[model samples]
Target: MDSSSSVKIVSKHFVKPKTIAEESKQPYYLSPWDYAMLSVHYIQKGILFHKPIHYSIDAFLEKLRESLAITLVHFYPLAGRLSTIKTEIPKSFSVFVDCNNSPGARFIYATSDLCVEDIVNPTHVPLIVHSFFDHHRAVNHDGHTMSLLSVQVTELVDGIFIGVSMNHALGDGTSFWNFFNSFSVIFQAQEINKNDDLCLKNPPVLKRYIPEGYGPLFSLPYSHPDEFIRSYESPILKERIFSFSSETIRNLKAKVNQVCGTTSISSFQSLTAVIWRCITRARRLPLEQETSCRLAADNRLRMHPPLHRDYFGNCISALRTAAKAGELLENDIGFAAMKLHQVIAEQTSEKVSQMIDQWLKSPFIYHIDRLFEPMSVMMGSSPRFNKYGCEFGMGKAVTLRSGYAHKFDGKVSAYPGREGGGSIDMEVCLVPEFMDALESDEEFMSLVSF
Candidate 1:
């Protein structure tokens, strides 16, 4: 007999214990969301979909067991409280002993939204499950917990998807990427010390010293939350994807800059402008609609040793950009790229690093975050995740998608990985009609492969 490794092959989700520091970190309140990070070694969750990716009643749980030996961890009911105060990591992290004995993971089958999932959705915000599959993490940002990525087997037609729900209080995209990359290493018989350079060395950086007029923080005239939700109504969680040859994207970046008269814009900036343009027209808003949204810019470069490839765990900040929708598209792609570069630069550095720290340290943390929660959207990049290579040698993931529906109601995501060397895969979910129009457009299709 062999000892169970941190990684194992399984068909279900599992829960694990939080680390020493992880247990100690308390949830800090920020607006409607929290500021915190939990190293619940593995909150492995997955969905079982049938062939063709439809619901099926044939799925069952019986005598399903594996030697997971993972640390037992559960979500501490924030009861809606923040998750990054000064709580203990390993000890305060033990909310499982307090669990009402809820089974760790349950796989269900349902065809219609009305039939399958409605009955079994977790009634609580932080769901706790027990199992041995260590492949995912979920977090609650504001209105909903945002799941990063999903790991699942395909439904024969080469289609499979996983939905992760997580809280934004946890580290940032850098943090999530750290854990995910560690997961891959651990899964492949590699060593992973949380403090490893591949991960964060010290704890997460929480400094907040943002200048009053700093950042792309221009107040927009969007309607109230109630009014806003109704008009911008659609899926609260969205799954948008973009594809292109990795090489093609690099080339396009240069090409757009050449034509747009500025080298400030990169592939992401140019493509983002395209998405913004399409989105603006889709809503039939005035051509001058001042689109407001935020971007998660990596701050690894600002760290002393620089997070480098070593530092990890939420090492990023948010940047809110504002400009006329028409102007955004009306300008050369290069100009759009320049604005994006500037907006992104504002979010990085010790300034934002310290600002976030002070904000979290303040009593007005909750109040300040809530003020902006209703008026903004957050956009992230999947360009560097390299998810396609996660196949464990079976094969590249047939499809990699995010569980972000309305998280970015005005979300602008650009991930150009998939198709071998230079090809990119781009996706977006706006009004169904808007998506349909993009899908129907022959000119757009010429540039992108569905």
Candidate 2:
């Protein structure tokens, strides 16, 4: 059977919130941090689970559909659509969420002929995985007409894939996982006592975190969203998963600390350094060329007053560190690790506040094409997220996967290993030539378990 055509959609519909109060249907303003992500693509991520035994597929889908409605009640902004307000006097535009005009979140039910092994056992993730997510190649600004949140449940012969495509402007990775976790909690609770009222353990703090001098709405620099939108066709890229066990990660960290004579290097930093170095070597760029690594850091705790962890919007800052290709390649892993550690340490409350204040004065939107500069690597999604704990009464997830949106030559996403511990799984994307070079680099593959 053709893998691309294997996934067949059984039904598709919209799931509205169980209940929405009239007063709660007011506009939800976008934070400055959210405005900065206006042009980025939607975030597409999902989990692969072993098919549950003893439950009919019909019954399972019904429960999932019901719980989704209940979950939307708490995460109401997701059900809402983006609104572009224009002012004639100023000839400017601003965007906000119109809660009153919600058309509900998109829900899809699909069936695939593939099995668990078809997804988990491949060195390169199969192309069929891209079919699991909706809103393919759609940017976050498309939320003005598209659903801000889309959920797809694709059933395999021996597994299930629950894919979610969320608007990047609405939240960051922290917010994305929070919604997934909350949905699982409500789903599992229904299995226990269907009659009981479900409540989120960490209910989302929906208040927008605007700076002291900033108002709820900020005007876009452009007159229309089209002027700010960028179009780019992605090149053919290969994606592979590299697994690092707890022991391997420890050894990497210990090696970095031993060389640097400091214990400040974290496992994440150590791992990212190795990838940056290896990819640089694989690319075979000129010594004089400059390379950079950009990582997204959560800002909820870095705010002046420290916003709640449950804050339901974009609260993140990109930490970028650069080096000449020659310098990066000549240095040991310790050198690269320390560079990342230093940048991470610099994101203090004052620094975060300054970043917010500066952005308010001159707001800039991130274009998709500009995200992938040459010789650059972008690290997204942290291993700290509880990817495996999203249990819907059907055991833990076997692994995680991402969709086609926001993918570039050097995009890397980190996930906690399925076996737990400090292990990590990096979903790496690169050109075919670069991937071949990376797979053959023994020094780098020596640390990878798979």
Best candidate per lDDT, number?
2
* Global lDDT of model 1: 0.38
lDDT of 2 at 137: 85
Compared with the true structure, model 1 gives a TM-score of 0.58
How many clashes show up per model? 82, 0
Backbone clashes counted, model 2: 0
lDDT of 1 by residue, 311-372 (tens): 32345555667667677556655555666667866654566557555643442122222322
TM-score of each model, paired residue for residue: 0.58, 0.97
Model 2 over residues 294-356: C-alpha lDDT tens digits? 887998898779999899999887799999989998988888899999999998999998887
Top-TM-score candidate index: 2
User: Which window of ten consecutive residues has the lowest lDDT sum in model 2?
Assistant: 1-10
**Model 1 root mean square deviation, Cα atoms:** 11.6
The worst-scoring run of ten residues by lDDT in candidate 1 lies at 62-71
How many residue-pair clashes does candidate 1 contain? Answer: 82
Per-residue lDDT value at 362 in model 2: 83
